[model samples]
Target: MNEADALDLVQFAIWTVLIASGPAVVVAMVVGVGIALVQALTQVQEITLTFVPKIVAILLTVALSGPFVGSQISSFTTVIFQRVQDGF
Candidate 1:
């Protein structure tokens, strides 16, 4: 309803997004680094080597973390809806 309220909502939205994305991001980073190390050691330098494993790992992470991410988003939505209901 006001700047502070708007800012609060925005901040909360960002945090929710970060929380939801945390696992996937972490998995991707780890997978990417591992792949990079392997490529460095083996000197394969294949584009697919860099991308494929990272993609697969990220997909698997998302699949495994689906429920946790869903609940975080759902909770954020609930809070937003409640604010709307309260005419904020």
Candidate 2:
């Protein structure tokens, strides 16, 4: 493959990774912020308090977004394979 094709593939890979990970990341971030707010208000300085809620939020996000993530990865793979088949 030429440099342009390689660049395009790299860019696509990055975008696909971002798309696949965005939901869980966003949910975790939101949960973390919420937990932080609660901790600030209630003075609960437990480390586990922050971790558990973020983990649960991430898990829930993954469970809900599994199909979407799968489809995106599969589609990216298919495109890559098609490019390979087409000789770059």
Candidate 3:
């Protein structure tokens, strides 16, 4: 592949990674923020307070979004293979 083609692939790879990880990451971030807020209000400044909720939420989100993430990765793989076959 040429430089432009390589760059396109890199861009696509980034997008694929973002799409695959988006749900879990977003859920984790939201859960962390919520926990922080609760801790702030209640004066409970426990560092461990954020871990369980974030992990559980991230797990649930990943489980729920498995198909979407799988499909995105599959599509990206197909595109890559198609480009290879086409000698692009």
Candidate 4:
């Protein structure tokens, strides 16, 4: 592949990775922030309080987004394979 083509592939791969992970990470971050706010307001500064909710939110996000994530990865893989087959 030419340098430009290689760069485009790399950029596409990076974007795909970000897109795949964005939902779960964003959910976890929002949950964490909400939990922190609650703790601040209620004075319930328990460590597990923060960790548990974030973990649960992340897990739920992963579960909910599982199909989307799988499809995105599969599509990226297929594109990669097709490019290879095209002698890229």
Pull out the clashing pairs in model 3. Answer: none
Worst 10 residues of 1 by lDDT: 45-54
The whole-model C-alpha lDDT of candidate 3 against the native structure comes to 0.93
> Any runs in candidate 1 off by more than 4 Å, and if so which?
none
Question: What are the Cα lDDT values of the candidates?
Answer: 0.94, 0.94, 0.93, 0.91
By lDDT, rank the candidates, best first.
2, 1, 3, 4
Task: Report the C-alpha lDDT of model 2 over 1-88, residue by residue, as the tens digit.
Answer: 8999999999999999999999998898889889999999999899999898888889988999999999999999999999989999
| lDDT of candidate 4 over 25-59, digit per residue (tens) | 89988998898899899999899998888888888
Model 3 C-alpha lDDT per residue in residues 1-88, reported as the tens digit of each score: 8999999999999999998998988898889889999998999988788898898898899889999999999999999999999999
Candidate 1 local lDDT, 1-88, one digit each (tens) = 9999999999999999999999999999999899889889988989988888889999999999999999999999999999999999
Number of the top TM-score candidate: 2
In terms of TM-score, which candidate is stronger, 2 or 3?
2
Per-candidate TM-scores read 0.96, 0.97, 0.94, 0.94
Ranking by TM-score: 2, 1, 4, 3
